[model samples]
Target chain A: MTCPEELDPVRLLTPRAREVLAAARVVLERDGWDTLTMRSLADELGIAAPSLYKHFASKDALRTQLIALALKEFGEGVRPVSGVAALVRAYRDVAAAHPQLYRLATSGSLDRDALPPGLEDWSGSPFLEATGDPHRAQALWAAAHGMVILELDGRFPTGSAPEATWDELVTHFG
Target chain B: MTCPEELDPVRLLTPRAREVLAAARVVLERDGWDTLTMRSLADELGIAAPSLYKHFASKDALRTQLIALALKEFGEGVRPVSGVAALVRAYRDVAAAHPQLYRLATSGSLDRDALPPGLEDWSGSPFLEATGDPHRAQALWAAAHGMVILELDGRFPTGSAPEATWDELVTHFG
Candidate 1:
């Protein structure tokens, strides 16, 4: 079997692909991840199950693209910030606004090796550069994610102001 | 309606209640979260649907206990460690072994208010105590969680060693 760099499936996306994805979002937001099956998505699109296969390979492939879409949206959602505190808050805001999407986006494997054209820059790159060290950026990113995940999971203590805690994390890292 | 402190549902768990939870785990592990319903769990336990109501009030309640059980198991999974590096490894190991269970446990609302009786001591409590500040504890916790989560989600750069990165986080915080 030949490596089909020329035959990349995503490059062949049609208008119908976008339609399938939009229907997926509706199902995801309404019924959630578990119920968002290929059959369910096909039903939403008013298409046969086999028709979805022509656009997307499988449910897993569709889910991966959905996560990528969410990540791209998250990158666009936050205004780029030079300061650590502002960046942290922006990250938190995105997670807070779309917790389910955030979870889905966070749980999936990102295609880092070969992202599509114009899709390589991660949402955290600017904030990461501002930290001056890639490793420090990773730590800061983890810290913010930890706080938000804990908060979303209701594992943080009552009266724990995550915003204030975020500010403190920024200082702690610096 | 009076809030009966004596009528706490979890506190009132019996041996049979433990059986119900054990059966729920079987269903959860086998069928995934969507299929781990009251009816499904009942089928696993060889009981009628309404009988589960005696031990657990709702599916949400069952889910909470399942998470608590996961946390308790996680606490027991790791050997006690006072150093940050060891603690981080332990947390990662648990997640790696049971990714789905970890996701469920992390997503649910943990009882941070009082913690179930003996749960004040988490696997990382000693490491947190080593930091000597609750806020620092939170930061370190977040850092470890963030790294593990990113690693799990395949967000880390290809060929990146998360173990080394974890060590760097320990040094960064310390």
Candidate 2:
């Protein structure tokens, strides 16, 4: 089996790409986007920074790839559920499960203009489709993003359950 | 009409406090929270940093004072609106009007637990009252915060009419 670093670019091989993405996730989780430099990633893999250009062209390229990976993971996590309520729960669960990646993905740090080809179109499609209204979809994304950031910051009501708050949001929209 | 630096501690008037707050706002807007040091503020005002200590004991004290001023401005901006639709519009306007202050106020840069007496309690009251549900209120704040941040970041849909998005959100909740 070819390692992720040596895999062919054109074909889909889940395990290899998954390994690279997992390493990227570790970089995002431990050091955050600010410190997730190419050098750092290369160091993590015991390779030189320039060698990373083989997998990803630039820092932004690496970030965009990681964001794409995150969105794919996000889509997968929310795939088992359907409808508004289940969708809301799945969205919240994905955010909670990968708080760091969620923050980095939604932090407005990635340039929409520079979003990798085909990735931007699919990033928020799940949530948007679930809401059934573009405006509501935008608002729901903002609300969920806000909830996760506030939750991570420890700004939400102390002792107030996350699931309960999520239920109220769903009810309000419903 | 004494300058802020000349105001006596016990006898300082509202206008004097406003002047100091304005200086603080300038610091926040230009340098952001990280570089908003007393010396930098004093340099902006052409006064000694020690003089600032008379008005605000520390950076935390100055930040809390600024948060109070920001909340006051925010409250005043949204006070006249009635019903949920009006409230959402008013909230959006406040955010758009002072994007920097809005970011600072909601950035979790301040110490919530050490908030000055009566400051935090009164600051978010208007928002809480508008939503009428503690959970909803919390969600609303998060949503509003995220909306402004994303809007400023230019992540929201730009082409066509986006105000319709707000209208849809309001309709959904109502």
Clashes of each: 0, 0
Candidate 2 has which clashing residue pairs, if any? none
User: Clashing pairs in model 1?
Assistant: none
- The residue-by-residue lDDT of candidate 2 on A51-74, one tens digit each, is 766666577766766766676667
Q: For model 1, how big is the CA root-mean-square deviation? A: 6.8
Docking class of 2: medium
Interface RMSD list for the candidates: 2.4, 2.1
TM-score of only chain B in every candidate structure: 0.74, 0.72
Off by over 4 Å in 1: A1-12, A26-31, A35-57, A77-79, A108-124, A159-161, B1-62, B76-80, B83-86, B93-100, B108-128, B159-161
For all predicted structures, in order, the TM-scores are: 0.69, 0.73
What do the candidate models score in CA lDDT, each in turn? 0.68, 0.67
Best by TM-score: 2
Please provide, for model 2 over B84-173, each residue's C-alpha lDDT reduced to its tens digit, 9 standing for 90 to 100: 777788888887778678777765545655444445545556567777877777767667666777786576657222777667667655
Error of 2 at B154 (Å): 1.6
Compared with the true structure, what per-residue lDDT tens digits does model 1 show for residues B55-136? 9888878887877677666666654656666767777787778766766677645655333654534544654566776667
lDDT measured at residue B112 in model 1 versus the true structure, 0 to 100:
51
